[model samples]
Target: MASSDLVRRIVLLVVLCVSGGAMAQTGQDTSLVERGRYLATAADCVACHTTDPAKPFAGGVSIPTPFGQIVAPNITPDPDTGIGKWTDEEFYRAMHEGVGRNGENLYPAFPYDAFTKLSREDVLAIKAYLFSLPAMSQDNPVSELGFPFNQRWILSGWKLLNLRKGEMKPEPAQDDAWNRGAYLVEALAHCGTCHTPRDFSMGSDESRKFGGGAVGSWQAYNITPDPVSGIGDWSDDELVEYMRTGMVAGKGGAAGGMGEAVEHSLSKLPEQDLRDIVTYLRAQKPVRDPADEKPRHGWGAPSEDVSAFRGDETGDDPDGRAIFYGACSSCHGMAGAGTDDGEFPPLFRNTVVGARQANNLVMAILEGVHRTVDGETVSMEAFEHKLTSAEVAAVSNYVLKTYGNPAGATVDAAMVDELRRNAGEQPLVAKLAMPGLIIGVIVILALVFWLLTRRRRRSLR
Candidate 1:
């Protein structure tokens, strides 16, 4: 019980207490950053912002719109080109108000309208994670929109009609899980941006929410709860599986934009979140387009004609059956049935083949699929150069009639040729020509006004 011993023990206890406090603070900081990372993943910011695999978030992705192509800008911590110089307030305004650092309106292609529903804390967390990344000095390409479409002011008008600013309030009737799913799907995921048809001003058509819309050549299929046209028949498990792996046996696989979403975003999400998305989707009001009488995979029965394997070639033009034997029979069987393992899905009861529009099927034939699920690489070779447009049309027709909806058998060589020529091109509105005409008329009016003023001055003199 010496006085010296008591003093030494007291000093040691004080030192330990300070060290423990410091460690706890460090842990909190790490947790915040990790939370931010998870939020960014849920938001799927990397899909649009990161064009190159090597340069993640150093954005240069080309998003095509009816107006033109708008390249995504860098979001890296680079002070000059990226948002490194952005204040927290500036970043919030951009996300919540769809305004830039200089107070300019951002194109809806950025999906800020949906992002506006994000809470301030969530938006800041995303910013925090983005700032933590390595800065790249890459400058994004300028947008190629013509005339009035290129004008940023036009977006102000568009926003007044479409943009709904404010965080989503939970519905009193719904449970916490349902509300969470709704927020994630409608706000963060912005599924309506693609699935909902556009109005005259290019805003999403709320009346047909998740009832399907066209994105370039690809159709974002109806996801409403309609038994025939939408996903009402899809089991919860099937929906979750499709979101996770981008495929469901006897149904279909993802391609194009949906394919990209699966590869980059959906596949990377947690299983629970995927289930939540399905929950929200299932609760949607059933909407059916009159054109769709049944589910996409519920059409035509499989056919097995022996003439196809015999190379009969009886038709005036080369039949699709003969072409299938020569080119496609190797991977896909003579009967159009794929591998037993479901690595290559069977042609019958396939989503893509049975879709109301044959655009996806045609494009798949021309471009082919090359996506990786889990660790395995799933690929289908492109036949654009190998097969003539006529041959493609014939084979596509045969597959549609034999293994899919006969109504979808309307594709011709001319349609194939046009699809080939405009392969990677954006869908431009026919009204693009009208913009140039308007500008010309305005210029002529200005000149006429000037001439009249000059004549008046001369008369006065």
Candidate 2:
């Protein structure tokens, strides 16, 4: 062979080797990115971060707390507006310490308290997946809060009391499945964030873990193994079905935050993960509330005369019967039997309607249900713009009386108006009774500090 041809062959070999190495590196990166994507899904990051489906991760979600409305910031990789400029360490700190890139304390609304239990490897993986996304330039609205609540510095004090900053360790005594379930429920899913009642500091009430709590207009019902207030009566199959479809016939269906969760997170989870969650939930200590002696679906007798109650549509003020017939009867029959195919659920034996509190039923009428399951979209058009508050109250009361819990029959127009106004807002303990206490404590601390400084100055003089 000629010397020139031999040299060219060597060059070709070197180029091939370099190309192969680059391909191997690319494959490894892709695997990590995919793993990150799965972890993010498990965490349900998109539920809070993405408000607009068209602009996923370009956050503009308004999260209401006792302090005020804190908007979720963009998590996309946009250099100017999103986390694109964030280093891996910064992202990890935000997850593990609830601190921002600028060293400012983040509000607990981010759920970093639970996220702190995540392994450093998992946290970094989530960051890696987020960084792999296309950059989106979306500016989030500034949080609008009242007085001392607006002060982010207050979170530092709050964190000192509530933040359990550490990664979760697997229980050695438990089987691998149980351990996995425990981690998913406690760390990744953070179900207690909604289900557990809050203390004065707005931390999850560990004593009442999964013992039902209110989330804005919706109720995050008990998931413990209690037969009365919780899911003790539910079979593993029933629990799995509910998690996957957000509904189980003769039981109840999910709406509001729970519905959003089913639609965006739980429904898409792997079947084994769903089973694991169920297993963990079933093992929880039953914390029964007397008020929930029976499941929501078990309350409320069906109205016998619903079919005969058509009203005068031509009248100036149509009665609930007329409104029901005109607007809701087509999907939910005159007898509230719902569609036979189960696409439109029966109002009778429905958990939302049968619940002791009428808030969910009222909100459903006003906001309507919109969820997707198994590639099919389920929607109920919102009536907020269409019906007057009084009209909504009337219709809701009618449904409650005719097909649901009679206790809910007392809902009035004023109640509907209140629910409408505070639609998606979260209840803050500080707003409830802590504000005055917090102020008083601050005042006492300030006075004590002032006296100490004065004494020190006098001694120096």
Query: Which predicted model would earn the best TM-score?
Result: 2
Q: Which stretches in model 2 have alpha-carbon errors above 4 Å?
A: 1-13, 306-322, 423-461
Measured with C-alpha atoms, the lDDT of residue 303 in candidate 1 is 65
Candidate 2, pairs of clashing residues = none
In model 1, where do residues sit more than 4 Å from their true spots? 1-22, 309-318, 417-461
Model 2, span 108-127: residue lDDT tens: 88989889999998888888
Candidate 1 all-Cα RMSD: 3.3
TM-score of 2: 0.89
Listed in order, each prediction's TM-score against the native is: 0.88, 0.89
Tens-digit lDDT track of model 1 for 251-344: 9899878887888778888888888888888888888879877788997665677777666545578688888777777777767788888778
